[model samples]
Target: MTDTTRPQDPDSRCGFVAIVGRPNVGKSTLMNHILGQKLSITSRKPQTTRHQVLGIKTIGPVQAVYVDTPGMHEEEPRAINRYMNKAATSALKGVDVVVFVLDQLAWTTADELVLEKLSSLKCPVILAINKVDKIEKRETLLPHLDMLSRKRDFAEMIPVSALRQTNLLPLEECVGRFLPQSVHFYPDDQITDRSERFMASEMVREKITRQLGAELPYSVAVEIEEFKHDGKTLHVSAVILVEREGQKKIIIGDKGDRLRSIGQDARIDMERMFDNKVMLRLWVKVKRGWADSERALKSLGMNDF
Candidate 1:
């Protein structure tokens, strides 16, 4: 279904676009790059994104609502993975365009699996060959694109460097053509479809993933208990829930050093994001087996799982 909320003036157009692919193809990075802001978190690790994040980008006559979805991969075959995959699949429904982002370094069976799904999509599909900066020669990139182009029918194929902000405007222009004329879906100044609390939790999670690394990143959740603004400063308090006492100890660190570092990093980013000083207090709590517990997962916004 086309989004008819945008103004119908000759110069007005708005629509939704879904960026889908296997994990770590720079979907979140592309969203942030297009919006010219950090609307979503980025991590080198796979499956860093767990939700369908909306990033708004307005250029001339078009406002593109870009949905950054979780990476699709085969896992334990449980409810969580099912939900995550469903979130990505749901994004394909009723959209103006679909950008199938791909990593240039390597193509795997899993990549084919994602493309196979895209081949069945009804909307126009654009193959965005991300990480073009990693490719040394332009000629070398053609073969990779050709291989995938032959596998499915893509509306348009374009190479882009989402991290380096290269060759993106053309892709944006290409996407804008698919948007229907309508009223603006959001204010021109709006940038994302996430709440401050949600963004704050995501920032904390990004820091945790960066410092603590993989094994512990997936086992943690951040809950914002207090967020208050007093004109002078933004005071925030959050709980980092872990699945075990050992995980809690690891997060808290020796004499709370680790937790302190994480808090400091998150606070700095939060301050920069909000354009004000932030007082952040972090505490670690244990909710053993929360990831596996359906009730607990639902409370943590993992209900899709």
Candidate 2:
């Protein structure tokens, strides 16, 4: 734990800024682009981020602690869905600024739900229209920006593409202007608040989510059973949980080929993240209907907050 209360630079500006949006809206991608590091896991699947991951960035004397939250959605049927909603909404409180990321042209009821949540908050909201790279017509933005302007009074609005690294400097500068004058809460070099074990586990899950078919990724979860560091190499043992026996087979593949691919890809990602050698071991286990069980979700640290 970093000493947040220690004596900080007097002229430093530090505050919490949250990234919130509907599922698969590129909120995680935006944070990673701004920080210049991949702290949050990214996949095409909705609700891939089930927890709040913090990334700290220092530019000159300003430190923006960006909290990448789970996508706030209306699907509350399962225990995991409800937990993700709670985790996402909870990030709104005590935040100095809110960066509401929205799809370039896809606005649905889920986006309305997020807008409603921001409507009542006291903090300033910076509306980020993400994925502008997909916009083929350059002249269409004027009217779209006009329509969004009438929706709500935003502190600042910018069209940015997180994946292509477009207009991120203006977005970061807009966020920095609203931060309260205070001392830096974290050291300049700290990129994220999460530990290696958690990131290693998420990296494995990201590969699984991206590699396997649609339904199986939603039913799967990764748990780091053990993580140890020997000065030279980091050892990680992860268990991949599934809802049934059939899903387990799919992840393991024929002759365990799929599992080996996931392990190889995850090991490479971890090695790059840790800047050292990583030995990763994976096992697929069946935790029948675990996603639907509240006790099971809590046991795996999904609802740890």
Cα lDDT computed for each candidate against the true fold: 0.85, 0.90
Regions of model 2 farther than 4 Å from truth: 1-10, 213-217
lDDT of 1 by residue, 48-156 (tens): 8888898988776678989999988867455566667888888888888998898875788878878877776677888888998888787888787778778888889
Which 10-residue window in model 2 sums to the lowest lDDT? 1-10
- Alpha-carbon TM-score of each model against the true structure: 0.93, 0.96
For model 1, where is the 10-residue window of minimal lDDT?
Answer: 1-10
lDDT of 2 by residue, 1-305 (tens): 45453346565788999999999999999999999989999999888898999999988778899999999998788888898999999998899999999999766999999999888898899999999999999788878888888889999889999999999999999999999888787877788878888999899999998887485747789999989998999989999999889898899999999999999999999999998899889999988889899999988888756
Query: By TM-score, how accurate is candidate 2?
Result: 0.96
| Model 2, backbone clash pairs (residues 3+ apart or across chains), number | 0
